[model samples]
Target: MTSCGCLMLEKVEGDASAKTRVKAAPGAGAGAWCGSCAGDWRGRSEAIFPIYVMGSSRESTVAAARGIVDSPEDPIWVAVKAEAKSEAEKEPILSSFLYASVLSHDCLERALSFVLANRLEDPTLLATQLIDIFNDVMLNNKDICRSIRLDAQAFKDRDPACAQYSWALLYLKGYQSLQSYRIANILWNQGRKVLALALQSRISEVFAVDIHPGILSI
Candidate 1:
């Protein structure tokens, strides 16, 4: 793996008779292969050139090679991730849940989408479908994104029971329901009344809080 934890496959040039060697790129750590990419490459001469593994694409590999880092993350999201990690360490039973809901995602929006989707998903409505809907609305609407962060902050600031931002994000039903309503409202405004109503029904079923999607709540 590279210094950035991205898997880098380097081809070793040698005699025609010699087998092509697969090794890590320059500046890679010792035994650089991550678990996903750890395998025998012997006799696989056809596997020439570098194969980027995990989240690293060819473009990302080139950027990493040039020592380029991704843009800075939102501070609220950074804190949420840190708190989730610490909570996971303290509560081993919740490790998988924390990882899946927070650590596995790159940003707050994605993580929140996953959480809400899973929570509201039913036999008829799959989590994957809900994720797409949630991602669409959350990613496109700047106002909703800002509201989500502010809501999370409010939970942490006002709710004495809410010790961490991740707590509000991951566990609070009220917070989750509020976010669901926000997405549903956007869908309703966009003339997707049927889909929005479905989401509203699901939210009511899951969170036990019924709110009209058409109503513009402040």
Candidate 2:
């Protein structure tokens, strides 16, 4: 699910238990898409929502975007690093992973770029090759970067399992998967559909979650 200049509805990766995906009932116009079972739709798209927003509605997504969508210099980045540093102190073996995942990146964008690039790397696009592209999207594209923060904030807001931002950043495959999709979506919008599909395939392969490019809603 990539960004489009036009308003588009996305069909998120479906859950087996869900009989059908839902959108907001009519009359909400195009601004709202409320998922009753376990998601929502907004400018953020369900690619990011199901993992972060959970069952939240458009209002929640908007509020999250308003509140936590800070720039690459957010203070929370500092706190996340501190938490990672403390955790590393407790578990030396995982210290390298923690550092590379969160502590090393100065901001959420860099961290997300690193995470998504590595996760989506394949024979065609090595992690090193994808890292530069992912970093460019995460840093230069405001919407995708903001979606990462909103999704992270939503995970904290909606999922009791998400006890910490660092946990979401480092541990959750759902969060990572959605962010990876967001980058792919960006690539798709840039007319790099082959690269986008390649990343999307890697996401499904690595995360066990598949979102069809054709999942459309009215």
- lDDT, candidate 1, at 130: 91
> How displaced is residue 91 in candidate 2, in Å?
1.1
lDDT of 2 by residue, 156-181 (tens): 76787988788887789988887777
Residue pairs clashing in model 2 are none
Off by over 4 Å in 1: 1-72
Candidate 1 lDDT over residue span 159-181, tens digit each: 77788999899889989999999
Positional deviation of residue 63's Cα in model 1 after best superposition, in angstroms = 35
Model 2 C-alpha RMSD to native: 9.9
What would the TM-score be for candidate 2 when compared with the true structure?
A: 0.67
Model 1 worst lDDT run, 10 consecutive residues: 49-58
